[model samples]
Target: MRPAILAILIGLLAAVAPVAGGATQRASVSVVADLIERAAPGDEIRVPPGVYEGNLVISKPIVLDGNGAAVFDGLGKATVIEVIADGVTIRGCTIRGSGEDVTGEPSAIRVTAANATIDSNTIEDALFGIDLQEAPNAVIRNNTITSKDLDAGRRGDGIRLWWSHGCTVEGNTIRGSRDMVFWYSEDLRITRNTVADSRYGLHFMYSHNTVLEGNDLYDNSVGIYLMYSNGITLRGNRMRNNRGASGYGIGLKDCDDITITGNALLANRVGVYLDNSPSSIGSTGLFESNMIAFNEVGLLATPNTHDNVFTRNAFIENEQPAATHGRGRLVSNTFARDGAGNYWSDYAGFDLDGDGFGDVAYEPRSLFGAMLANEPNLRLFVHSPAQQAIEFTARALPELRPEPTLVDSSPLALPPTIELAIVDSGIGGARMGVLAVALLSAAFGLVAAMGSDRRLTAQHTGGGA
Candidate 1:
């Protein structure tokens, strides 16, 4: 009897397959495209509440408003929407079901024209969320994007700008995607964005004069990576728990004229990693007033990385506050600027003159750190007995002490206040609220236990009565 039932169900599913396939084919007709053709170039087309299946192309200036209740389904085909005209606005739509093939670089929306606005859209199950190619002065804001259900390495970028200069990307949340990348783009203003569960929250290459401010990035391979970019300003961003393979809160390579200030780099493998930055001769980098805290290595720089000034930053409770990438020391980098230096939690120096600066210079000369620099594998034994023994031996014997990696002549006597406001994506708030509730419950339980004990004592010794 069970075999007969299974056979009947299989036959029914087989019979429905062709009918379902025909429905999908019929839904592939571009309904929005017909509406676009009928409307004038400058007219506003407000799509009503429904699922409009098929791909769309906007080739003239117009406002395509979905009224917050419309969805544009791609039928698992190529890009869902393509904008080829300047001054186009696409907002308040749900875009999903793009083709999963990475070879075609399928995106929910691909804009190739200048001054387009893509805002307040939810893009899901897309291989690539939004791609702006040579689309200068574009605005991308308040969008939530999640990629296809592929492995992290196979997923395409959440948002990508290729040669799209003078763009503004703000208030977007991206998750489970490859990267939010900018390539060969200049004068970009990226702010207030939250990106997590991605490869790189922000990746920039050859993009100059960009400002990345007030963004929150966590649980990514790397928070932000800038390569071959110049005149980039990174300020007031919170990068936390980015502990992937190359887990740097901020990684810089061959970049020049970079300013990193007032940011919090917390709980990453390396808070900041630098490789030959200030690559151009006579160009300098500045890192100031930032919080580098609770990482395996607070700052890790290659031996040849030079001309970077670190000042007014706070390095707090890292396993290794600073370390070289390889065998050499970080003597080329400046730890102090204009008689002011950063705050190190491990600094033993004191300020006798009440000047808020340490009297002695702060130098990190750890033999274990030097060994870890030469052989990064040695970090496996970090915080173990072996590491303690090595550090103790170096401290006991002056000759065994390695040269200081970097010196701060005027180390701060106290940690400076760093002001940063990151937009939380509610996960942090929920976790914190749970912790508060747990704490309160524990306290209440303890109080009840104590009261019960008091009552029992009163029955036995009359003290509580």
Candidate 2:
């Protein structure tokens, strides 16, 4: 609870002002919803360490400061905390035990209020962790939310923002839920969070002008997926090992003006899946400086995909570096910008002049591979002698060349080096410094303890008096 409160305090100082209107009519509540019901609007309710039974509602513009000591248990029948008023603040509490009824869609905290803040709370065993419906500019930060271990269909989103425009969701670790869903939410800034073992770490539908950065999304069905969204920027994120049924580090469908840069996508089925992305010829999607490695397919695009550009990204050790479905070649997408292309691990082209560009065009897929891409059924016989012979024949015969999946006119023979800078500003830098110092101190203490143990062992073993 102390650790949880500390996390909240770090986020709170920036989001919320110092508790104003000092102690005018502060009330204390224990296991009673009536206290909150009876409190006046804009009043402060101090909840001490105890289990508060039944459902609670914040109908007035007020502060429910639990300080990580109070636990609101729903007793398995209702949504635990419901905020119905504007400017409601629910902070530093453990809220759990939401109803599992499919119709109810119960959540640990459900907010219908604008400008509400839910911070520094540990929420567990909930159907939905925090459901915000039309709650514009709501800030959810520094909360740890875990949902019930149920099927993806039954498990609701850890935090759902429906029509919650201009909201800021940051520094919350979420797991065991359907997804962190943003439906029709725009201008959102989601950062510094970790999500694992979920359906989709982040799911966006009709969400635009969203910025997602410094987030770790792993072991999910898909790390991040967007459908029919535009103006999305994903940076400084790590997405790894999400080899689920539809495993993709990031899946884009008809998305436009996407800027996915400075991100790492590792060990997923498809590092990035682009389906009709950059929707129109006029729209553009830029993939820049991303590390896409150790995945089944580094970049999988539909045959008709166009208006998408990939530049300065590294494709390493993927089963298929770049692939297209129903394809001879991807005619529309550009692999290189200004004669500088991505670094492909399998590119054997030479850079003789040391200009960092391959003299020959680096093509990731051969003619046979392109055929297999269009006709995926041929993949089953990939290692068979017949398939190998056909591939060799295609290589031997210049006339039988398959269309290039990715044609990099100037691919980098050597891997392009990109230095990812960690944010060292405000609380982030302070936190990193504290962590480094703590780690060094711990290492020194361990060394001293080992030395002492060795001396004691020598004395006990009769090697020394």
Candidate 3:
């Protein structure tokens, strides 16, 4: 009886199946949406190497595999793939946008499930390359994300995480996005990514216990921004060329217990800008074993920031040197060519002994630096001949220089664990010197203009006639 029933059901299916143009089989589905609609949990959908134009929604726990370099084009309206189920894998595809949207968040791919992997894809032209919301234990790795619009207020990010935890974001190249990594989520590992031409390379707000390592953050308005975050480790990163009028390589505000080590900060308007407002009380941050070089100012610590340590770090050739805003301690750090001194290109202290370290203490903080702190425009006089003469005199006379806290008579030892001197030697120092010269030239131009105006007025008056 059961065999007869199965045979009757098969006969009914065959009779109902539609055929076209003398064919017996039904027409195969052409759109990816149709394929996804037909997919079941634990099934696999193999996409061919062609442009599939539509929004794809994966509601079942299935694998979507691109067989041969497939491309998913989102026709400039909606997300390419929106995953709403756990244990989904989307791999080996090129996903392109659905252009920018002012009213909503558009993404090339969005994963809102657990144990999902989005990998080895090229995503572009979306408001966000990948948006991970409320997804835990997800891996978004080895993707290239690019966007054309990088305007300050309009452009979107490469990867945006909201309320997601235990995610690993690794080995991605994110370019032309406003904020490459926007982390409101926590417990993330962001490693070995190259983020450039963005507004803020890595932005962490209200996120904690995140690790960012071995990343190259360059050409952004601000390389890394940490706000109200804690227990974050930023290690072995290179932040350079982040030069806008108000840009910083790294900006920390109201953050605590953050460790920054083994990073190179080069040619930024401000290498690290720390603001401790009244709201930020008892914030303890540590900056250790980083090469802060060739910046307009090595470290700008504002008022209300307290109990932070600048230890064992190299501050080299900064035009205005270090500016202290609030009370902070600088301990056992190298400031000059001598032992424990930074490799300041402006160091004039003599090495009286045969030892490599200078005999006299090299005071990195200067009255000129303090003056420039009050009047930042006076930074134009940083490398002026007159300024050089003053610095020389200050170095020759101990009282002339900023009073030394103490001198390290012994030879300076490089930090054993941290490779702070990773940058090419000539490039960093030369860049700082060039900036100093340019600033001086501007100052001289202003002086000449004032003098010319005064002489013209005197000539017109003709001795009070």
What lDDT tens digits, residue by residue, belong to model 2 across residues 1-465?
A: 999999999777534422442222122233446667778888888875666677887788988888777778887877988989999999898988889886878999999979999999999999999999999999999999999878987898999999999999999999888899999999999998889999999999999999999888899999999999999999989889998999999999999999999899999989999998988668899998899999988988887888888889999998788888665467578989977788999887788898888899987546657677667787787547887688678878978876567688878777767554444335557888999999999999888877687767877888655
The C-alpha RMSD of each candidate to the native structure, in angstroms, is 5.8, 10.6, 13.9
Name the best candidate (by lDDT). 1
Ranked candidates, highest TM-score first: 1, 2, 3
Clashing pairs in 3: 334-340, 334-341, 334-342, 335-341, 335-342, 336-341, 336-342, 338-358
Give the TM-score of each candidate. 0.87, 0.81, 0.74
Stretches off by above 4 angstroms in model 3 are 1-30, 277-283, 325-362, 381-383, 389-465
Write down the lDDT that model 1 would get.
0.92
The best candidate in terms of TM-score? 1
lDDT of 3 by residue, 178-271 (tens): 7865456788998888888888888888898999898888888888888888888899988898986557888888887888878888899899
Question: lDDT of all predictions, in order shown?
Answer: 0.92, 0.85, 0.73
List model 1 lDDT by residue over 416-465, tens digit each.
99878864545657888999999999999888877787767767787555
Q: Higher lDDT: candidate 1 or 2?
A: 1
The lDDT ranking, best first, is 1, 2, 3
lDDT, model 3, position 155:
71
TM-score of 1: 0.87
